[model samples]
Target: MRCHIFTRDDWGKTLDVQETECGSPEEALQLGSAGVANQPTEVWCGPRRLGRFEPERSHGRPLPRLHALLTLAERRLHEREQHISKQETLINRLKREGRDLALALCVLDTLIETQKTHLHERDLIVAEVAKRFG
Candidate 1:
């Protein structure tokens, strides 16, 4: 978003403003600090004025608008984190299922080999009995 830091005249008319392109309101606040002197500096997004900063006041508490913007950013970050966590969990589950399927195939292969060996033994016994009877 594009933000502007403006110094307003006593009549509440804008005297001068510095335009800065920022991703978030926090960045705008940081950029606005440099333009602020003894005059009150206000941050604007597009045509809408968001918040004002006073040099006399400590920066500990943010203005209501800035606070709401920061809160929204935080909520979006948390949602993305949760989505990533769920994706990781699903990937882990898929890996475990793949391993189990591989193991089952291995067991089936072993059983087939065992059945082939038994058939070979039975053939030998039948051949011997046929020769003796003939």
Candidate 2:
């Protein structure tokens, strides 16, 4: 099979194109993966795209593992957001009831700090993924 490998820059613009002949789609994928050592690459056979590979970061972790981590980070971030929302609601209710709010407010402050950490973690993972795969 004749395959074309497209090397893309950080902004996703095509920087170079190379054509090679391979025995199978797997071979084309391997070639593309190797190409990703220098830059992001896309493998195509005629009009069909066989695969895409990004420069490996995360200490040489595989692409699927990075994707899995991204998924987990996003889920955790979402859960943290919900917890923060519920905490805010509870604090508001305590205020309306004329209940002592020192402890509740303290807990809310802690939750806000934790939410900030989660946001930072999620943003880091997102930026890493975009940098590697874009």
Candidate 3:
């Protein structure tokens, strides 16, 4: 995250802001204070204040808000991506199974038709034999 340092100018009316990208809030605060020594300054990341540095007293180690937020967002996005991938795999498997089932049904239909034809032929032969013998 980028840290913005704001300080007052010579007239104490106009403000000057400088931005720096640092590893941690502590680092940013240290760099901000060192950049503008003996000046009343505040360090910020977006709208959240990391800490304040005064000429007499400087405070350190407030909180690590930006890092925590970024980590959480990244984890959630990874979980969603994994879920989408698993769902796509399941859908493809189901489609393949459905096609196999349709092919089996067509085979069963052909078998049934062949059995009916054989039964009809047997009944005709029986009728002809009974007409000659009885």
Instruction: Please report the candidate that would top lDDT against the real structure.
Output: 2
Candidate 1 ranges beyond 4 A from true positions: 57-134
Q: lDDT (0-100) at residue 25 of candidate 2?
A: 94
Clashes of 3: 0
Residue pairs clashing, model 1 = none
On residues 3-83, what C-alpha lDDT tens digit does candidate 3 reach at each position?
A: 888885322432688888888988988877786654578788888988766665234212342334334445544555565
Which residues of candidate 2, in runs, are more than 4 Å off? 1-59
lDDT score, candidate 2, position 75: 85
Worst 10 residues of 1 by lDDT: 57-66
Candidate 3 residue 13 Cα shift, in angstroms, is: 5.0
**Candidate closer to the true structure by TM-score (higher is better), 2 or 3:** 2
Decide which is better by TM-score, 1 or 3: 1
Residue 119 in model 1: shift from native, Å? 99
Give the C-alpha lDDT of model 1: 0.62
With candidate 1 superimposed using the best TM-score fit, by how many Å does residue 91's alpha carbon deviate from the native?
Answer: 83
TM-score of 1: 0.38
Clashing pairs in 3: none
Residue 30, candidate 1: C-alpha displacement in angstroms: 1.8
